[model samples]
Target: MNSDTRTAPLACAPRTPALMVQGTCSNAGKSILAAAFCRIFLQDGLRVAPFKAQNMALNSCVTPDGLEMGRAQAVQAAACRLDPDVRMNPVLLKPCSDVGSQVIVMGRPVGVMRVRQYVDYKPQARDAAFATYDSLAAEHDVMVIEGAGSPAEINLKAHDIVNMAMARHAGARVLLVGDIDRGGVFAALVGTMELLEGWERDHVAGYLLNKFRGDASLLDPALDFMQQRTGRPVLGVVPYLRDLGLPEEDSVTFKEGLPGLRDGVAAEGGSEEPGTGPGSLPDILLDIVLVDLPHISNFTDVDALRGEPDVRLRVARTPADLPAPDGRMPDAVILPGSKNTTGDLRTLRASGMADALARLASDPDGPVVAGICAGLQMLGLCVADPLGLEGGGSEQGLGLLPVRTELAAEKTLRRTTGVHPRSGLPVAGYEIRHGITVAAEGGEGGGTGPGRGGAAFPFLLREDGGPLGWGTHGGRVWGTSLHGVFDADGFRRHFLDGLRTRRGLAPLGRVVASYSLDPALDRLADAVRAAVDMDAIYDMLHLRPGRV
Candidate 1:
């Protein structure tokens, strides 16, 4: 659970059986497939764990022990009913820009490096990754491995430790997954097999066609051709699933133009449409706008809010995306976390969204403006990166909150639980950031004590009575450093109810019970199990039918 250091003793258990899911390209549903296998193995009564030697993503989760790792691995761990372990993802690359990324080894940030620098550091990264994989493999009966991007990237193959190389290291049976939904599935699968070296191709067991829609049977001819061409079986054709209620692996989901919005209409499941199911929808729909920053990170923080049946969540990318002064204003505005606070702040300003946000916050009846992590920093008066931690320089914030932030060398990663001061509701989440924020010189509510009347106050009080965030305008304008705050159902409901009260609508009593991923995981497992040949999967893993 602690930061991975070389001095730590390595486990010497025998190599465990493993199955690696490699994709034809990024977002080919490799992560979801690995997660389903994890759940399936667990259901069959085997000790299972998920691993990705190296991950390049801005979406991350802080483990209970205060370590950080890719969020996809964390989701897979949940599928196995296990807490996330850093060993599951030994190397994490969080991109701050197109050319550079913050290198995280063993749950701790080492430094930021450009592509060339990272390539030179790969030897060390490879060693750490192998060591961690060994440690995790020793603890589990079987390992479900996930490969990053594609294995056929000729430019990256030499330095690759996340795809075929990792599969070879683990002696894993590789299932090349292709997204049939993207078209050219046949070409993508055949081309990948052709590009891989003979030695690398030896580990290939078969293929899994993912994200298919309509008749899966229609793919039979292509499936047969793939098998005949590559001498590999097509194990499954998984149907495309919508609104699966699972966290996405990365920002590629935004490419389709704002999640939950297709052709300017809300998708099914938790759509903005009125709910006929019991207590599903509130009397009035609360429109929530989330500012889509250029380097938006942890966008999943708003997933819980987006799932509410009565809350309509929209992504606002420019000033024009915001509600006009004369039009029906949104019920709230949220600024999500960012990988590069100063950089995104500049983007907001250049696009005039910063000014728009400030105007909204200043309005007496404007929708509640809330911020999380970097968003909280952007709400302050200034964001300074004196050490060049975030490409250096400082930027003027939106000035909605009376605070200032300074980027430090060391990053903070921890799980937190607190009480919402206004509602006295319990809240739990985690913090992952490098900026240290404090009250401005003449800022109101500078003290940690409770607020007098309804003036500016701390957003949350830690279990030990320490304050966590700042709030003003009677809780209408607030920001917190904690991500996933809305996941706390009671607190989320209370906050939403407040919005209803402000709009003169009766509060909708608790509609649904608290949310849990167990049901969702089970549903996913069921669908995948029905689609894929579990018996063949077991044979690939050398696992028995009943147990390990």
Candidate 2:
């Protein structure tokens, strides 16, 4: 132990206790573990919060107050039974290309810069990160901090504001987590410790082995050896959770395929064909197809339906992936949000999905088509990027909706609550974009409301009576700027039931019940609490078993 790390009763700073969960590598369960502790602390009657100094991912969500943050922290906030705030994740890097990103500070875009240019902005970003952490600490009794990547990235250590720097700033007790399922857990854990600086090593209070499979008792010998080598106890071994149904922090998890209870299920179509025997409705489950655009953002909007047992969600990256092998059409097609709308629209066209989708929309019996955010923009007749916000040019849309969108210099960001104009059910969501679409005159080049067949009206409204997203009267096609409208149980069920009615299947009396990860949050926390030593963790943070 180092003298610098020694605890002096009088010198100790009195503030909210914080514990950091860092991983030996990226995707080593750091976010999930932080969430587990957040829920556990909240369950113990303590005010808790989740924090990440910086996050780099396309997956993001809007807070109730209109600030944007990482989706993982939003999930953790839900686990803590709290609304997500911008303070939870102060620095967000939304990658716009391989070498550049649109830097966001405190939930607003600062500017676009290359990776090298971003290094110079670190000092400012770091200051903003600390400011958010300090503000969050003032309101919560405990803060469960999550670190990005690993603290042992020696090449990037100097600009490391998210990990070791944050640990030192918060005086946080660190629990280093390693993934045993990835193999060589011992080497990864010890190697991480050896690479860290002496002060960084001193701050680590214990180690955790995550994503373990098989018998826990079989690891007793390895655990003993690790403790003997590091003088730190193995805090816990989290079992490999199957179908955990939590929104992932990034796209890596989906690289193999969507992580859900149905991983082994077929990638396309449901168990039964589109329809059942004669005089019987199709035995097919709800088949929802999602377009996997190159720069897809906020794809978590469809997570609720993906996890439902009766729903089969297929991610279509190309035209061939859209239709089933058995020649059955999907029940619904959803176009997700995208960071680069024009670029992805081009990709959609080149991949032949644009033509296929147009055919689907043209067929009277075609599946219901819906879009959110950028998807809504693409559904319109024309999208103009006058300022070259997303690469300069005007692009023709699918022409499914009679609207025109123009990308602007200013972005509209806000959290909203409204009622479904047709269903009359309440809906809540958020808007984060830099364009405005309006109804144009009929037969005008710019386009107007829904064309000849569909009636045009705003989809929802704010409590202040302001208009929100828009939808079509035909009900077969809808588009909205709201990113999380499906989060509302009533609206989601009503929409799904409508699809069922279109397919001649019986309506599901009860929806998935909970879609915001509430059930999975409790399940994960229970497993973690059982595996980890609560008493030791409390002692490490010098915290009592109650609210402050």
Candidate 3:
């Protein structure tokens, strides 16, 4: 079949030329490469949007209108200078387990399905994918499509809605990306091409070698040989970039969370194991520990903190994994978002971290304890899952925050922008959770019933008219259902400054360096543009190359 049959153009589509980035393997840098194209197009003064037919990942974001989509597309949208929309990621699969996931169609969860069951829904999913694609294509001048995993997964190619199938459906030319950092780049590129069917092979316009290290001259011979063998040119060789960070696509990002099992620190620094003594942690302006839940989601919430040179962050799966307070405890303890709150909470308690956190929170001079999403619910007095939404009926919480939560049938998804009650600094973040938490009847100590005594001070204001988070003056505990709360420089600086003060450390200057995605995106695009032939890419897309 030709491109017309594969990805039939929508009646209203703006006749925009599309290009697809497929990888030789998962984490082969397809997402960032697509983002590079998006930024490039935007810089050329072309309106652009990023597209992914389907994304299977726990990391997600809620659009301004309360629609959910994959975080990768959201990042790409930012690179394109556009607002993220559900249309960017038509079908999102948030895997709750190895065997099943909650299927989100057009930004709302319809239901959960097993791996086998989702196969039966592929035809319908493909249609939905095109519908969403057409919507964006109708508005933008260019669409940069990102493929998931590899296109050569022989077992999954028949029912595939991503990769080659997506390329065909979008009538787009494909650039196959392979990571040289993983080694065997030559074998991987050749093997992938050999595995493709005749039409699939023809759809690919060229090959892009990503994450390359060493001299470019050393790779010329192999590139020539590959081009001769597969008749596909090597478009570029992107050098191994340092400090180029982005939100990871899966839990693999937390490969560092279990440092006891792995050697060497990961690039993300989520894997450091606490040494035997207080000196195990390197001296830094501030230290923070994140409870590494079994099914942690949106841990990128801490990505911004990594930008603060004076801050040191670590992830702990158990109490013993935590660094010895060594008379100087961590400035803050963060409990991040979790896919399964009740289950992860049980894991937390089993690991003895929950009790440890309670003690820390109860200590008047202890580190500031903060929880987001599932972390927020875990701090409450009680949590209920009547329908067993997260694998429990009812469970006791850390009781650090005077609140109670119940997992409701519908999820609360919104992009919230508000001001911190105390800091009066503007803060913005998104909330994606199934629980509705309310003030419990308990007083300062935390009671079981609800009353005026149970009221807690709300710390975050919602643009839609609601309290978003709670904090206590005495306990130094903060809880919020909002994820990405740290992305805002004003709020993060204000919050971290409080911790710095509590720890007797000097506060930061008037302006703290804020974390942003723009510069990183520009760097990414520059790398790809310098390495890849824009003339060839423009030719592949049937467009004239603009001056670089």
Best by TM-score: 1
Query: Model 3 compared with the native: what TM-score?
Result: 0.89
lDDT of each: 0.83, 0.81, 0.79
Identify the runs in model 2 with alpha carbons over 4 angstroms from their true place.
Answer: 1-14, 261-282, 443-467, 509-512
Best to worst by TM-score, what's the order? Answer: 1, 2, 3
TM-score, cand. 2 vs. native: 0.90
| Model 1 segments more than 4 A misplaced | 1-14, 271-283, 324-327, 444-455, 511-513
Clash pairs, model 3 backbone: 6-169, 7-169, 256-271, 441-449, 441-450, 441-451, 442-447
Q: Is candidate 1 or candidate 2 better by TM-score?
A: 1
Expressed as tens digits, the lDDT of each residue in 388-484 for candidate 1 is 8876888888777777799998899999999998778898989999999887765743222111213346888788987678887777888899988
Model 1, residue pairs in steric clash: none
Model number with the top lDDT: 1
Tens digits of per-residue lDDT, candidate 3, 278-319, equal 344344347777888777888888888776645666677777
- Give residue 359's lDDT in candidate 3 (0 to 100): 71
Give one digit per residue, the lDDT tens place, for model 2 in 10-121: 2244378999999999999999999999999988889999999999988888887777888999999999998889999999999877788889999989998898999999
